[model samples]
Target: MNKVLKQAIRAILPTWRTTPVDVMHRESGIPPVAQLLEARRIRFSARIKSLDPAHPLRPVLLPRKYASEPLPPLQTAAKKEAAEEFNAWLESVSPLTVIVYSDGSLSEKGAAGYGFTVHQNGRSLRQGAGRLGPAEVFDAEARGALEGLKAALRLPQSASQKIVVCLDNIAAARCLRGQPSDSSQGVFLAFQAPAKRHRQTDIRWIPGHSNIAGNEQADVLAKVGCTHPEPMNAAPTLAFLRRGAKRQCKDVARAWWNETAPDKYRSLNLDFPNCCPPELDLPRPVLHHLLAARNHHGDFADYHERFGHDDAKLTCSCSWRKSPTHLFYCRKVDSRHRMRLAPSPAVAIDRAIGRDFEKFVKLAQSSSFFEKICPCL
Candidate 1:
């Protein structure tokens, strides 16, 4: 297997200078090409340590046989009314439950990571981890749940085992379990094989960032796992794919703007649109109307002239044609009225338009009244 993989890597990687590994390491602070190659070779060559219960790495960190006989039961959040009743039942049934915890994390810098630990009978039976380059938080979370469940299945199977997979994300839980019982189904059916061996597999929802020990541990582990040299297993799910597609679209949009946007916009100081298109900051319909009017493409006088509205005259109330350029100095609208409502309504806006188009867009987003002066309304 190792030899076949080595041959495949050699065949798959590009020629030296243009190789992805070479380009990846060209960035400052990245490891040298030789060191990176060696690491990859070792990673691909070495047999992965299994997550089986008998594996040396399977035991919980700081393993010690506690004389306590059994650890405390993992608790789920409860409403005020059920708080007391829920704890009483949770402790009673914990011994029959194998609580599995999973979590994923993404840093502000876009680093993606996930971690999971399986504990039963007061001992962590297994721990699994993985990570990715900058990615969406939702994708990381979904992968955490999916891979955690898959890892739990690799543990020693027993008919007596009652697995309760705990994840803080409710949406991810619903996607996995399919339904409420051990029989719920969702996007992935990987849990079915483990279900047959274990008497039951339940996905339990817990509140995130609320300091639940298992959940917290999972969160911390995911963050730590982000530093791993290579991700363990990145299984793409529907959500992950969807996020990837959206990211691709954003990238394409940015590229188009960079390549084809007016030269005048080069000095614009604008924030990246994390959730929407670059130039659009309003609701879709409103954005459409505003853009049409600004570009002389809507039901304006200039547009009507070309499309032949009843009045084919190209003129505004101020005698200047109702066009985008005409709006700039048409005198149809007084700068004083707009000044009262602009971010720098009096004169700063015109300055921004000359020096920084992005700053103008940002200001424009907030001042619809001022936009009327230049079809920007």
Candidate 2:
């Protein structure tokens, strides 16, 4: 539409339910335009009110993030002597010490789940798992680490005993180290923050599936937690927030397209605005000019008259009014130049727009068709 004319219609209508009218009466500032716009707005508003209400778009929330250190490499092989020493260190830990192993699992449906096992002197002290709702693997991994660290920090261990939380996911371990990488920030906010206050707690990363009993137990619990039937805490991670935002935008856009697209535009009709349908993917200007010649804003006597080129007379070289009506009915141009239209001139113009749009799409299928006939492509 012409910007000024659209604004005039908007000014009269309450903006919620205004529909496009036959804008051949293009006097945007005139009283007739306001009257026409009000009538159309009322009709469109009633129609929309009668239809089912559009589904609501949901909003997403996200956790706060802090500037943390860069991440470390996730997994490294343990050499023969080092592996033995690491196993020995685990074996020789004080009986009063608290140690935890955590893991995360992502379901086929992308549900986030976390699990942890707390042990004292190589015996199970407590074990639990929880779901993080819809989330990515890394975010779930971080959540598991936070939960394990949280558990380890609060345990009834001796004051002299060391507190250690281990996890196979290197990314989550880095988050525990206070590095905020993409979506793991939520874990820090919801669980890791409290654990951070207790400085005695230490986080360790070990190679996954290294025959470590605690780590294997955590891995199983993580998988089980993901498909748990009960509702779990759905803390908004950065990844979940991003997904929600993208979905909301797409839904709103689709709804708007459905609501405002021209009623005459059928399933296959492309939107050909201003003589060029970018969606048509055409390669030449011939069809563009050809299509525009049938509209009110065309390079015809009616369009020229409206812009004060003549004395508002729309009569053409064929001695007929060269308005949109004449384009469909005019015999002087070509006997075969026919356009699909209704009996009413206004409706004919509206309906023809969709019909021509579809025609243009079909014409555009052959990329080199225009290039063969017309040198300028």
Highest-TM-score candidate:
1
Q: Quote the lDDT for 372 in model 1.
A: 50
Best by lDDT: 2
> Please, what is the whole-model Cα lDDT of each candidate in the order they appear?
0.51, 0.57
> How far is 69's C-alpha from truth in model 1 (Å)?
36
Where does candidate 1 stray beyond 4 Å? 1-92, 107-111, 119-128, 132-158, 179-189, 231-242, 263-377
TM-score of 2: 0.43
Where does candidate 2 have its weakest 10-residue lDDT segment?
A: 22-31
Evaluate residue 171 in candidate 2 and report its C-alpha lDDT on the 0 to 100 scale. Answer: 65
> What would the TM-scores of all predictions be?
0.47, 0.43
